[model samples]
Target chain A: MPARKSAQPAKPAPDSTRRSEKSRRAIYEAALALVVEVGYPKTTIEGIAARAGVGKQTIYRWWSSKADVLMEAFLDLGEQSLREAGPVPYAFPDSGDLAADVKAVLRATVDQLRDPRFEAPSRALAAEGVVNEHLGRELVAKLMQPSLDLYIGRLRAAQDAGQVRPEIDPRIALEFFISPLAQRWLQHTGPISYEYTDTLVDYALHGLAPR
Target chain B: MPARKSAQPAKPAPDSTRRSEKSRRAIYEAALALVVEVGYPKTTIEGIAARAGVGKQTIYRWWSSKADVLMEAFLDLGEQSLREAGPVPYAFPDSGDLAADVKAVLRATVDQLRDPRFEAPSRALAAEGVVNEHLGRELVAKLMQPSLDLYIGRLRAAQDAGQVRPEIDPRIALEFFISPLAQRWLQHTGPISYEYTDTLVDYALHGLAPR
Candidate 1:
């Protein structure tokens, strides 16, 4: 839900809006830090409110559950990372050269993965998601699906350009670029680097078998 | 360590050996069950001993820590699954058709991932491993490395047989076959099926680009 767009009307006054934004940012920070310090189960809405220096009713007024708050907090974190990386558009690049464009995107992903602020909380939530199927699906739907859609869109363009095979399923094909890095990070299977991701893109685009 | 080999001498008497084996099996079962029920941190040697109806000293005598015991128990579970699958050699199959051999192996893996006995405890351990780097590396080194090695061996053989590109690094190339399936299972990203795995093999070997 990071790039969600909706029409807004009946906005609050400027002073109240500023205050609300401040409180919201505080809540996001507190929720992320709390999840990292103590895990998902122990991170309560009340605890987040306390850490954020707000009332419990304030959090309840917004998110219905701890999971809701945490998911939003994660989305906000991704946006923050993107902002820090500069004012880049929120679409996968399509430079006509499929390999170069994908490599550029994956290199950016490598930087994001190595970001310490992103690493701890991401792992905490991801660990919980592994065992909690409900939250796992929610994470995929809300957090992952958008990024996956970008990959799909770019691959479709590649197919149109006669770069990728028209018959290739973009959904499964995207996994070849991302899943290896994910498995290595999640399972400690191996080290991750720009070179590793570049290699993944290469292997994925070109067959492992001889051409 | 399912296919671990070691020289054995100075064996115990048959009766004592039988009793030891019975007790060891019980400990493994108890450990696996406890982890699934209450999770990794709550599981302890005392609890496993009580559940297994053995002295704490018995668990201590064989294993030094809960992680140690759990790793061995998982290895045992894997061996049990293999035994039930019929007597097959521990090496990766080499029929010269890399795609068929890999697909066959991944199909068996899909079955194992879906097995009732393997599912719960494996999830519990995997969930913990995501957050705990120490335990995560141990899990990879002891439980997963063997299977990865098998894939590496098969890929290397494919290279030798000129079925694969000589320059492709088998270590990373093998991830194309397994990591997609792993991500689906671990993250609930997609449904896993024989058809899905077969497609992965086909895509991996044939490349995503048109020939």
Candidate 2:
């Protein structure tokens, strides 16, 4: 049900594009803040509209549901982080040093996870996704899959470069790098620091078994 | 607050022990079911007492709060799972074949995660823990630490056996094995299966680098 696809026109007028971008950013910020403050079940289209200072019709015009808006909001947040980091969208640096590249990207992720602007809203949405199956699945499909694809792509590159073993599944191997950090951040299981994540990257890539 | 040691006797007489065990089991079932049905915030001592058909005094006689009751309930659940698996209490097996033991334990965990009786109640508590920092910390300290200790103990044994790298931190290395499965289970990020966990164990034990 979340897989609705509507192709937009190849190009829009310059003014229209700018206006649309503005509306989109506003909607994202509003949706994230509302969910953080009032929680998921209580956040609504009307609330997002009112907070964003846009009419209900404008939001309804773009996204079908508040879930859709929040998903896109998160996607935007990732892109914004990338832009701030002075990268072209999202790309795992292929410096040909697999371990260094991974550590660099994970460090960036740690910054994003710790960013006050991102933390509360992300936690709120993530909390809701835990209990709400439909929303949870949609989140995986929209927000998470892209980031996962980047990991897959990087691992594939590593495989080609003979850095990673060919027999290893990129999907599973990637989890060894990210999931530990995620668990610490989400569950307060342990302290997350550069040293901690750097250690995870090393342990994951080099194997816990002896060299 | 979670560290408060109850003044109750560690081991009561046989008659009282039997009576206490019965009351404890009832409280655990009531707490798990109530949290699943109504969630953590709404679940109260009085509610658990009413649902378990036990008096409020019965709950207070052993545990101090609803949080304490829920924590013990999860511990009991883990112990029950261990008993069913034919393990004495709860422990990670050390057969000197680290891979085989880890795989077996992980597979059992996969089964437990998928169990309907375990899933709902655990999710209910976990969902609340995500948003409530105080409760989340308490849950980790009370419920999660014991299982984590088992993992740490096993890793230490592995270190002694030379199955693991001497320099690796057991705490961090354990995350590579446990956190991925946990993230997938808790966040619905991906499918959880025996094959998946086995692969994780293999990846963590062996370096992902070209051997």
Candidate 3:
């Protein structure tokens, strides 16, 4: 009877909502820090709960598992970075200039990749994802797909504008601009810089073969 | 003094050499199996020794670290694969058709990547390399660079033959052909197939824009 009553309680006040937001932020921070320090395999929901000073039930009420928590944390971090960058949150700009817009977003991505605060945690998660197929697929679907959709959106705009050829699949065409940079960053295959990415943009847009 | 004398004993007989080869194969198999079973971080020299029916001293005598052992194991696996495929070991064919050569090599890579025997262990090491910068860089230098050099050699041949534009940096240009395929495989971004790779070859050799 008591459990049923608690479950059917009225909505919380604004103050309680504020408190909930604070707990959420704390949980996110705890999850990211734990993953970076102990690695993804060792990070646990209990650890996040203890570190966040929240109950395990509080986390269970919100997310299903540690992977869910970590994925949301990463998404929140990306949003925060975007907000701090002083742009419209999460929109790939379309100023009717496909090349410039892509170059701009990619340059920002290069900055984010090199940022010390983001690099370690991202690397930890990505490393785990590489070997864990289920986690990898989930990360791609939940965290990465949104960003990729933005690229696809922009590419479609380019195609509509007659800037990108209509025959090209936006998904495949987008890889030419992004994957090289990603491969270099993830694998340490080469040095990453705005100049290098800018070159990639030029080559991808203009094509490698003689026009 | 007796131990030193034993260590400096006379040259091995033909039978002893055959036994040594068997031991070497056993060690390589053990190392690969351990890495695939337990992952790179947990797979140690001692564990590999136990699995191989070898002493720690044997591993130490042959290699300095597990990384060295695994790297050599992977190199050996690559060589064996090449030999079994009935191809000349370690050379990218240059038939004076740059596009055909690139396609042929990439197709072979596709087969290698799909092979179940190679995939699991390779993923294990590659996943480790993503987070371990030192190991990642070393992997690139030792294992990947040899293959990359083959691409560079082929591009140079193309330039000489007036098929590829000489002004284009082969290193940067090569990324168009390789990085997209790699990212697809590593990240599960898209499907990989002969038709897709062949399209990459055609698109790369000719500019995307109308001539």
lDDT of each: 0.90, 0.85, 0.83
Ranking, TM-score, top scorer first: 1, 3, 2
Candidate 3 lDDT, tens digit per residue, B1-211?
1121125337878897676677778888999999989888899999999998988887787787888888888888988898899857578888887878889988998999888888888888888888899999988998899888888888888888888777778898888888988887787767889888887777677744435
Query: Model 3: residues >4 Å from true position, as ranges?
Result: A1-11, B1-11
For each candidate, give its TM-score against the true structure: 0.95, 0.89, 0.93
Top-lDDT structure, candidate number: 1
Best candidate (score: TM-score): 1
Query: Residues A76-143, candidate 1, lDDT per residue (tens digit)?
Result: 99999999989899999877899999999999988988999999999999999989999999999999
| Candidates, ranked, lDDT | 1, 2, 3
Please write out the lDDT profile of model 3 over residues A1-211, one tens digit for every residue: 1121125237878887787889989999999999999889999999999999999988887888899889889888888887888856668989998878989999999999988878988998888888887888888898788888999999888878788777877777778888899899888899999888887877777765655
Q: Score residue B27 of candidate 2 by CA lDDT.
A: 83
TM-score of chain A of 1: 0.94
Model 2, span B1-211: residue lDDT tens: 1123556576669997787677778889999999988888889999999998899987887778888888888877877776786746456888998889889888888989988888888888888888888888998998888888998999989999999999999989989878999999888898999999889999999979987
Between 1 and 3, whose DockQ is larger? 1
